[model samples]
Target: MPRRSGGLRSGTHYKLRIKSRDKGAHNIAKQLQDFKKEDIVMIRTIANCHSGMPNSRFLGKQGKIVGKKGRCYAVSVLDGSKAKIVVAHPVHLQKLGGLAVQISKTNEGVV
Candidate 1:
């Protein structure tokens, strides 16, 4: 069967699955990689990452997709505790679900 882009499915909930070459795409925040611009993703919550640097202030939170800024993705997160916009890389995401909001085909000039 052909692959579908939007809506819900039984397989991966991400926009796209990472290939073998994309394994290391999600290792750390600094060495983060993969994922294209505007790609909606789900970042795994850092449970035990509450100390030092940015993590010291904002850990254990699920970030939201806003957009990208340079190599880092601008994220707006609300861990059910606090909400803020932070810059993160693709490696920080695990592709849990699709964006609740999808771009309209008409807006994209599709017919």
Candidate 2:
């Protein structure tokens, strides 16, 4: 037997599964959502759609939008002390509110 190499979705069944009640049709608004540069957004991987999907580690993490690459957007997220950029489709991203203010405040030593 040999050790298995963990991939992008190595251990994320529960985290990405959609509830039966919530599983019907994909929302058009979500699929066509638009984001602007510098916008704070959360990485939410689509369960079935793997196109332009980011790494599983970035799931549920918040990041700032850098730019748009075709139908996908470039998001910059801080993993520990390093800043990494991830390209993901709009369906895999959700706009987050208010958390940006708190993050800036903490960085400025105001909180």
Candidate 3:
């Protein structure tokens, strides 16, 4: 497949550092640390997909979000096929906890 202008590279997308979600002089950082071990999360899409699929599809897949090279979430979207997707950050995704896939990532605001 050809490289899309904004598409992510396989290896380049797997070197991101997880952001610190903490409160000064508190144990909140420890709680946030546990979230990283989660295998899957529910999130929504903040970017436009040129694929022409419905918006629900992006939010409905059980993709793996890993901290990649660019500090992007290497999302493995499972829509009939497995796509190694990369999002700029994980915080962009809204954690649904149980059975709701509605993660959202910011494509313009942050780097």
Cα lDDT tens digits for candidate 3, 1-111: 996574342333323222355223433332232235334654443332222122334554455555553434555555554454545344334444544332423211111
Model 1 lDDT at residue 26 = 34
> What's each prediction's TM-score?
0.38, 0.83, 0.36
What is candidate 3's local distance difference test score?
0.40
Estimate every model's Cα lDDT from 0 to 1.
0.46, 0.83, 0.40
Per lDDT, the best of the predicted structures is: 2
Best by TM-score, which number? 2
Provide the RMSD of all predictions against the true structure, rounded to 1 decimal.
Answer: 14.3, 3.0, 13.6
- For model 2, how does the per-residue alpha-carbon lDDT over 35-95 read when each residue is reduced to its tens digit? 9887888899878776888888898888788899999999988787778899999999998
Candidate 1 per-residue lDDT over residues 4-111, each given as its tens digit: 665322343342344566554334643455555444455543322322113323333444457777766776655444556767555455443433334322222221
Where in model 2 is the C-alpha error above 4 Å? 105-111
TM-score of 2: 0.83
Sorted by lDDT (best first), the order is: 2, 1, 3
- Global Cα lDDT for candidate 1: 0.46
